[model samples]
Each structure stands twice: as structure tokens, then as C-alpha cells.
Target: MKNLKALLAVPAAFGAVLAVSGNAVAAESLVEENLVESVAVESVAVEAADTVEAADVMVAEPIQLAQVTSVSELSDVRASDWAFTALQRLVEEYGCLEGYPDRTFRGNRAMTRYEFAAGLNACLDVVIQLIGGGDLTDVRRLQEEFAAELATIRGRTDLLEADVAELEANQFSTTTKLRGQVDAHLVVPFGEADGEVPLLDDDGNQATDPDGTPLTTRDTLEEADATFEYRARLNFDTSFTGEDRLRLRLQASDSASSLVNAGGLASQSGRRNGFEDNIGLDDVYYSFPIGNRISGIIAANSIVTDDFVTSTIVPYDGPAVADVSGPVFYDQFAGGNFGAGVNFAFTDNLVLDLGYSSEASNVNTDDGGIFEEYSYIAQLNFLTDGLFNAAVTYIDGESDELDTPDYTIAGLLNLDFGRVEVGGHYAYSPSDDGDQDSYGLGVTVPDLFGAGNQLGLYGTILPDDEDEPLVVEAYYQLGLNEYFSITPAVIYADNDSGDDSENIYGALRATFNF
Candidate 1:
């Protein structure tokens, strides 16, 4: 069996009337205010009266907390950590918790009965609240059976039982982790049915949509797909913290799509032609901070400004709607990347954010050859009055042969008035290189049909009149419950080359926190 030591440390809040000054004082409350404060003072002190008295019940050595995986992880664990914080103080000042020399605490490992029992008793002893009501006989009997090992509380089984019992009574807040979700998609488009249209390719090839019967099969058109997609993530929380956390993000989306017909002709072309799809990643990152004033993260898909933006149709928001999808962007940054920043409150209606991330790269050979490289991105943001939010971003160090450009400037803004929220953006490339200018805008609100649900309406227009053709997109998402939702969306394009195009997309998903 796994040593129960790890499990014994779980938080178990119990209260008792500690006769103080001849009056009843809630032990839980007193510990919150006084015991914690006492430990915070410079040197640790154990008042003789406050120390745990030797009883038939045993005590255990303390276990140290784990080092956070990243800066963001640290912030998340700290926020919403009231009960855990109290426990931490008790363990630290009491010199009861032991950490491995390597410094890892293995906070999630399971625990045995003895270890759990000792931890419970120690917590109860320090809080001095478990003395009044419960029968001590059962606790004493259990401790004696494990006395050889429970002599000092270094992971005893009886204490573990008591701790588990207290937790089941809902004496504290700490959420338990349960399940996860995995997603995958692929999207791609190549042959334009219209001969006059400019093909959507990196080489600027002339598009050719042969004279096939006009696809009147459906109200919507589907683009060709090239690759398949995949994604997975886990969510969990402790009631004590009152905060939820998610981790391990991975996604790969196919780059092409197939035509869906609304009419009979759709069946005849069922086996028509399909092309190979390229794959891309989506925004793959973990978020875990709870308090309003502080939080941070380290992720490859980390976009400081994208967190607050409304639409992707705007030219400068980064890439055009067609060029950027959730999966493509995910792989573009690779998950091993790191970043750190904080949200600072200037006042009720104002705030600021600053952050930075390192770039990643790799090489693949086509027919023959070899190459190598790396990249980095940086950003700054400011917001006020729920009306305006502005951000600037820069991308530097893309390799030459990979066809990746060196730099681009991006910005995003949101304006809220009464019941409507409006958003806008712009992006520019300084060199004569790849992808020039882009821009977009959108709006949203609540209870459009007089129902409890919210309603969102958004639209984006991208690319300056001169270079890249214009592309427009719009979408709406309705929340049906805490874990279920539906999104309906559409896109249209009018290129300088003269071939007009349109697309409609929709999805319904059932989500739950584990």
C-alpha cells in the first residue's frame, strides 16, 4: 500500500467550544484569527498551554508542501487557499512536515490509515477545538493498535480515519478533482470552384473552380479538410480553496473540410474529390488563479491580450480568421514554453497586465534536406472603466526557410455601454514580407429572447483594401447550463481576384467540471 503519510495532510476543519474567560469561543474561529497570526510572527514559539498534551491518541511528523510546477501554478495554489494556508502555517511552525531532500512534496499521492489518523489529531490538537464533544475512547483505541508507529504521529492510521470523518461532515472547503475532456478537429480548403478566384495558398497560386453544377445542395458551403484534430484537458478543485484548476492542454485540428449538401445532387458527388489536410494546434494552456487582484500563467498558447478580445475578424488581431483556428495556433507555440505576469488593480474600474514568452521551433524534410531555429513573443496591456482595453504585441525570430515572417504589431479594444459590449482590433507587418494588414469588430449582450440565457452577436472584417483580400466572420454562443453550450457561426470572403465565397458552421457541446 502507498504510505498513507500523504493522505493524512488533507484539510479537516472541526470546531469545539474552548471555554475562554468563562465564555464559549468557537475553536475554528479562534484558530483562524489567533493561531495563524501567532505563527506568522518571526520566530516560531510553542506556548506550553497551547501545545498538544500526550494522550492515548498519537501525533505525527509533518509533511512539507510541494513546490509549484511553474510561476502560474504557484499563484493559483495561493489564491482561494484559506484553510490550506492555515494548515501550512501549522505544519511549518510546528516542524511537523518533512519534505524530501529533492524538494518535491507529492501533494497528490494517496495515504494509508495510520498516516491519516495522526495528521487529523495534530490538526485538532493545534486548533485546540476537538476537546469538548466527541467521545475520545474510539480515538484512543485506534491509536494504541498502531502505537508502535503512531508513538510520534509520523503517519498513523487512527488519525487518518478521524480526518476523513471530519471532512465528510463538510467542516471545510476543498474541491476534489474528477474528470477531463479531449477534443480533435481538422479543417482545410484548396480548389476554388471559380476560375477567376485567387487560390488560398502560400504561393499565391491562381485558383480554379471547374465548371461543375452550381452546388445548390445546401444553404452552407464546406471547405476541403487536410488533417485530423485532437485535444485533452483535466479539471478539478478543492472546496477549501473555492477555486477550480485545469492542466495539460493538447490539441491538433485538421486543415480542410468537405461539402455538405442540402439537395439531391449532393449524393452524386459524395465520392468526388478530397485533398490532403495539414494539421495545427489550438490554444493549449492551463489556468488556475482565483482571487481578483492576482494571477499568472506559463504556456505555449499564452496570449495576454487574446484573453480579453471579442473577435478574430479584425485585421491586426494577428492572423486572418481563415488562417488562424484553435488547433493551428496551439501547435505554433508548443506546450513547453513559459511565461509570467500579474494583474494589478489601479482602482475599481482600472487595471494593468505585463507578460513575456519564449518561442519554439522544429524541422521536417520534404523529399530531402535539414534545418533548425527558435522564436519569442512579448506583450503589454492596460484597461479602465470597463470601456477601453488596449494591448501591443510583437513576434520576433522566425526562420527564413520555414517561410515564417519575423515581426508583426497587434492591438485589441473593447467598449461597453449600457447593455451592449463592442470590440475592435488592428494588426500590421512592418516589412515587405508576409501577411500585411488586418482589422475586425463585434458586440454582445444578455437575455435577447427574455429567457435566463445570454445572447452574443459578433462580426469581424479583415485586411486593408490594398494587399490581402477581405474576409468577414460572425458567431453567437448560447449557454444552456453550467456545462453545456451551442455556437452558431458564419464567414464570407470577397477577394481582389473576383471569386466570392461563404461558409456556415455550428457546434453543440456538453461540458462538466471534474
Candidate 2:
């Protein structure tokens, strides 16, 4: 062992030299690198040899000796302590100091000279490694070699630490998760059709006044240029219980639809576009499970009609599809409103759902109307989530213009073939004046263009025997990235206003999700 006195002589003398020269003081900064050898040799025979002994040194168990990564692990090393930074440096940066069995330094307790000397020896070893091979000349060599590079690295590390601190200080909600979607549509429609008095597929009666004659108009639809607009929705989803979700969706839409391309007179557009740009909070709902099989949802401002077991059996209803979604009058009951619904699972694959909604409930009778618009619906669903699925739906609809409830029964089904999926829905809509039937059929070729790419052909028939409202929509959807996609589609409508004239429409739909 080199004498402790000798090990200390070089560092003490070098410190004196650094003290005299500003450059040396700055250059001798990293003790871990420049003084490593001398620090290790300091446990030699003199300065600490008589003060500390091997038996007095701390011998920690394997668990207690775990490499300390956090300051919290040292029970007695409070941040408020005057020497806390030094303590942390010695424990973490140098890894030269170890705590007692209780994982604490016990700073308030007294210690023997031998214990103090042992700890000092620990620190000297770290210093020896820091100064490089226990030789002061190594410190000078390192200073000359990487002074600028180390300084730059240190500066960047400090900046990063500050950024993290700032971010943690001014953050948003802890319990709420934010999600959003945006859809932009470029629509070009061509055609103007003369309006006509229409009949139904079932030799149905016509819409008429109190008299026996039908009501008819000869209005002509006006043609326009390509229009571009967008719909955006921001959702804040919060969960009080792990199984329950509260969703608040803020939405904006300004685009309006023509009677032709936007599904003609069909209630549900087979060519589903996205939301129009009406900027406001559009949907607020809470869904919770009562048991493993029962689920429920309630809306405060807006809701989806087919919110439970009866999802609108159309692929275009999804964000992945370019077409507009949801049944127009059916989902909103003619307007966005408050509603409640429940779903009961009969088996793993079968579910039953019921709901009631009304837009006029929020309005005052004196101001506008109360109970003016409402619908109560029930649906039975059977699913395999693979080859076949079906739903039978019944809706009792009422409005200020209607004398009684309009009864409608809708059946929707989806079937899958190896690489193709086929789905359709048929609704028997009967009113006091007439009986109508609306139907849709679609075939989707998955991976036809590429993996996750789809080519879909869809058609909708709005029951009007005279001026049959028929729409055929075809689209190729391709995803460019995880959160973005583009779809180019064409729509052909046989009648825009129950007239003989036909119109063709083109659309480019782009969607982004966050």
C-alpha cells in the first residue's frame, strides 16, 4: 500500500496549483475522471489507517446494497438538508457511499472515528477514479482533450431537465384522455331534376292533404360547383369506474347536403359523408355496465340511435370508411337530443337493446314546442363476429306534423365470404298516408388493392314507385398512415327529387384521427 500520506500529497498539492490558476480550477472539474487512482490508493497506511478499521466498515446485505437510482430510497437524506446534493453525488454519481441495513444514513446519530475514516476511504477511492489513474497529469490531459465537448453535453442535459420540469408543472387533466377526428370532403355534384309526386313499391298510397288527392310540387333542383368543407370532433373520455366511460364530444359542421348525392330522400345515406361543420359540443354520453351482460348509456345533449347492440349495419358508418354514416332522421330523431338506452346480452352472441330520444324535450312549449319530436326503438341482435350477423329493429316515431306514431320495422344483416363481406338493411316504414320501404345492399372486397385497402360497392333504394329514389355508390379506400387515409368515390342517383332526371356526383374524402 502506498502510504495514505503520500496518496493525499499529490491531490493536496495539485488543488493548491489549481487554486492559483483559473484555467486549472476549471479544468480539474470532474473528480470522478481525473483523481480516480489517487482516491483508491488513499486507503494506504497513514492518514486514515489509524482512524478506521475493516470491522467498523458497513457490510450491507445484497438487498440493501442494491444500486440506488432514486434519492427517495435514502430515508434520512432529505432534499432540504444543506449537504443533500453532496450526499446524492457520493451515493449515485460515485456510488462510493452505502447506507446501513435500514437503508438510511442516520445522519443525526454519532459515529466512531474508524467508521468516519472508512467512509472517507470510500470517497477517496471515487475521487481517485475521477482524476484518472490516480495521477494529476491525467486530469490535465483530459482537460486538453474534451473540454468543449463535455461542456456542450452538460449544457444540453441541463436544458432537457428544465424542459421536463416545465412540462410536469403545467399539464392538463390527469383523469381525462383526449381523442379527436377530422374529416374533409370535396364534393362535386352534377344534375338538376324536376320534383315529382311519388308512389311506393307496394302500390303504396301517396302523401296527400286531408282530401283524397296527393300533394305535389314541380320545383327544380339547382346545380352547383364542387364544394369543400370539413367536420371535426374532439372527445374527452373520462372514466370514474374502470368499467364505465363518460364521453364528451365537441363537434362542428357547416356543410349542408343536397337531396340527391346525400342519399336522395333516403333517411340513411348509403354514401355516408362525415359530420357537417356546426361548431359546438354535439355529443355527451355515459356508458356503464351493470353486470357482465347488461350495459347502458344516457345522453345529455346528443346521441347515436343505434348506440348499443344495434350498430348501423353499414361499414361506411366507421371512421375507416369515407362515406357519411348513421341513419339521418333515425339517429337524431330529426334532431340531436337527450336520450337513454340499455343493452341486455342473452348469450355471448345475442343482445337486445331499447332506447328513447326527443329533441323537443329541451324546448319550452310556449317558445317553440315540447314533445314535438321523439322516437322509441327496440332491436334484437344476433352476432358471430365472423361469418354472419343480423339485427331486427322497430321504431315508434312521432313529430309535430304527424298525428300518430309512424311504425317502422328494420332488418339489417352482414355476411362474410373468404375475402368479401356483404351487408344490407331493409326497413318497412308505414305512415297513415302511405307505406314505404327503404333498402341498402353493399359488397366490400377487403385487401383488393392492398392489405387494409378496400373496394366497396353500395346501393340504396328509397321506396318511391313513380320516381324511384335510387343511389349507387362506389369507392376505393386506401390508408396512407395510421392516422390518415384518403378515399375517392362516385355516386349516381337516379332521382334527386323523385324526378326522371339522373345526377352523378364525385367526392374525395380525407380523414385524420388523434
Candidate 3:
């Protein structure tokens, strides 16, 4: 009876050995199947019969087993289980046993003979290596009994390694990633005033009509029709040092014209509606760290004031459809140009930003050079641990197109209260004609209906000495999914010029991102 009991404890002793060995590579390849457990029990009985009194051998019922890489991967194996430490030592420490591919250990299930053999064989291999091949007679007997199953497990492991190697060889770029966006717009304009308004040249001076009469806004709006336009952009972002980025963006669009003319407030016409159906390089820039707290950007093309500032502080800056998108005074000195900028962090919450840009930096003509039409901007940004954040900015520039020297100071602020946010900005630009002021207030409610859905309301007074147009916009963006969204917006503009030149526009935009 004593010998019979010792034979019965053989499997348990082998399980204990498995607990001491380290992680196993073969265990990950074990197959999930059930077979007679008597095969293993009978072998133990025959092997131990000569050394002890004869006894009956008990056969465990066949049961399902799974393969797992680590004990933690098994959902049923918890720290509180009585055998948790043993299982952890075998699977995590020695890799002698693994869980199912579906992350289950099925600890309550009975084990089949093949499963026991596989585990015992895996631990015996480790034991022999540790003991320098001086294993006892019983260990050698067990290895011979399970040799076939062990060979099968080893074969599966080799296949898994090959697959991993193939995947790594066929992987995509290691240092660069591609992202893209497409925006489609449908614009419908109504309530256009009758009678012609004088058309202004690029310099804001009145231009004569073909018949020598003054050209007017009526000539443009009367010919305007509801239109559909689209813009597509593909961005390739590459990183060389893990922290620095080089970005190249290719863009194409067919939205160069506006539906409504807001006197001189060009922002009221919308910023995204000007690509002229041409494909070109929209932006190219390289940004890198200069020091522990300083970062710099060198833009070969398409640089703007927002590139220099840390935050614009306006909630509608990306979604709004009119002047409310940003403070109008920013447009006074900050258009797309070639430039460079730097950000210096004074503290965790405070930063100083400076930038320089020139309109004709890429031109080779006598009248065109980096210094011919240039701007300098400085901004102080404040970010708090609380809900409020703000920035103050100053810009100095000269534009030969508008034939004026630009000097402007601006302040931006935002207060976020989780689902609800309020933002506003004020910009003042002093010109020889008069000091121009532009300001706007906006409110946003995010996740109004569901995740990714938003509602925004905005009102702004554009920076025009003659018109001082007031533009109001409301929009709701409905996110259908992570990669697609639709927005419907209504915009109204009325100028102090008081020609009853008020106009209303309805727009729908569909956006796809990937």
C-alpha cells in the first residue's frame, strides 16, 4: 500500500518540480485536446510495481486543457486560489504549463494523460539541465514515456517563432506614419441684398468695372450659386530622434471662392474655402528640441501665427464657419508664410513664444525677399492646473499687398467645466486710418447627444473700420463613428455700414479621418 501511494504521488511530485523551473517556450505550443488519463497512471503503476506492494491504479477522467503563455493570462487563476502559487511558479516562473489561447486556465477541469505527459516532460528537461544530466532512473523512464508528445510540442514552438519573424520582416515603416483627412462641403446662400456694392481690389481700394463704372459685390453674389466643394489632405509625419518631428502635408481642394462678401472682413467668408482645385504641398516643417525647456520649428512653407502660440484658447477655432473661428485681428499680420518659431517654457504652466515670417521668402524677384514683407510675433501663454487658461500676444509686420504696417495686440481666454466650455478673444490693431478692434465670444457643449457630438454658438465683431461687421454662427457636429462626422451650421452677418447688406448662409460639411 505504501508503494502504491508513492506511485500515486508521482504526478504531484512532477507538478512540484515544474513550479521551480523558469519560463518555458514549448508550453505556448501545447494543443488543446482530451485523451485517456489511464495511459500515464498505468505507466506509473508498472514502473513502481517492482519496488513496492501491488495496488489498484485510479484513472482520472479525460478533460479539456488549454495553452497559455503566463499564469496571469488565465482569467480563472486568481491570487486567492489554493493552487495559485503552484500554477504561477509553473507557468510564470518556469513556463512548464500555459493557459488556453482564449486566456482561460480551466483549473476545475480534469486533466488527460497527454496534458500530464506534456507538462511532466517540460519540467524534466529543465531538471536534467540543472542537475548536469545526473537525473535518477525514474526521471529517465518518464522522459522516454512522453518523448513523442514532447517532440510535437517542440515542433509547434518552432513554427510560432518562424511566424513572428516573418511578421516583423513585412511590417510597415518604422519611423514614419501616414494620416489623412477629407472634407466635403455643401454651401447654400440666401437673403443676398439687391443692387451692386462696389468691388474692392486686393488692396481694399475700389476697382472700376469693365464699362468704367465701379465694380460691386452684386456682380459676385448675383452670379454665386449653391456649390459643393471638397478638400483632401495626406500627411506624412516622420520622427528621427523619437522626440522631433518632420511633417509634410499634400493638399488638394476646389473651394477658392466665398458665397458671401462681408465688406472687408474676409474671415467671414470662411478660411477653409480657398484651394482653387490645385494639388500642391500645403505645409512642410521640421520641429526639434533646442534644450530641456526650449523647442524650435523651421517651416519651409505655410507658416501661420497659430504655429507660434501654444494655444488659441477658442473652442470654435476648428469647427466654426465664420469670423468666430478666430479673432479677426490675428489675420492682420498672420497669413500663411515661410517662417520659424521657438517656444521657451518658464514653468510647467507658463511659456513664451516668438516667431518671424515673410510673405515673399520663396520668391526670387528684386521686390521679393525675406525682409521685404515680414512679421514678428511674441506671445505669453498661461496654463493652470484649474479649468482656466489664457494667452496674450503682440504682432508687428508690414504687408506690401495691403500696403500697410501692422501692429496688433491680442488676448485669448477659455474656461472649461467638463462638458461645458466658454472661450473669448479680443484683438486690437492700430492703423494710420484708425485703431481696429475685433472680438468674439463662444460657448461649446461637448458630448451633448453622445460621445464625440458637440454644439457650438459664436458671435464676433470683425475688424473693419467701415463695416465693423457682426457675424453670428451656430453649428452642431454629429459623430457617426471614430472616422466620420457631419456638421450643419448657420451663419448670419450684418455690418454697421447699414446698406441693409445682411446675409445668411447655411452649410453642411462631411469629414472623414484616418
Model 2 CA RMSD to the hidden true structure, in angstroms: 14.6
Candidate 3 on 1-514: residue-level lDDT in tens? Answer: 4335344445544873433222221232221111132335567656456223211111222224444557777787799999887776666554556555455666665655445665677665545444444455666787999999999999999999999899778766778889999887777877765445544432233445445565444443644687777778889999999999999988776532343454332222112322146687878999999889999998877777677777787878776654346666655664444789999999999999999887666668464777777778899989875698999999898775452435888999999899899999998877777778888999999889999888999888877666687888899989999999988988887776666667788888888999
TM-score of 1: 0.42
* Candidate 1 lDDT, 1-514, residue by residue in tens: 1113222322432210110100011222233344455455535445323432311112222233453223223222343544455435433433233222233333444443433444445445433323322444555776788887656565566679889998788743344543455333233333342332212221111212345332222222333434333334443333334443444332222222331210011001111111223222324445445376655554454233334222322222221123322112111221123343445554554445444443232133331211123334444556555566665555453343232344556776667674666666666644444455655565656445544343444343333334354444443445566554443334444444434343333322222222
lDDT of 2 at 259: 31
Error of 2 at 288 (Å): 1.3
Candidate lDDT scores, in order, read: 0.37, 0.59, 0.68
Model 1 lDDT, residue 25, Cα? 13
TM of each candidate vs. truth: 0.42, 0.58, 0.63
Q: Ten residues in a row with the worst lDDT in model 2? A: 17-26
Compute the lDDT of residue 21 as modeled in candidate 1: 9
Better of 1 and 3 by TM-score: 3
Residue 138 lDDT in candidate 3: 63
Give the per-residue lDDT of model 2 (tens digit) for 1-514: 3344445434433322221111111122222233444446566464254223321221221122444555578787789997677656555555555555455665665554334445555556555665557855665887889989999999999999999888778756656788988777777867765554332110011334344454333355454567666667789999888788899877765433443334422211211122233366666889899899999988876554565445676654452222323332243233335688899998988889998776554666432443556667888888776888888888775655432326778888888785988888887776666665677788888777667678888777765323446777788888887798888888777754434567677777788889
RMSD (Å) of each candidate, 1 decimal: 22.4, 14.6, 15.5
Predicted model with the maximum TM-score: 3
Name the regions of candidate 3 deviating beyond 4 angstroms: 1-172, 194-224, 262-275, 334-337, 403-405
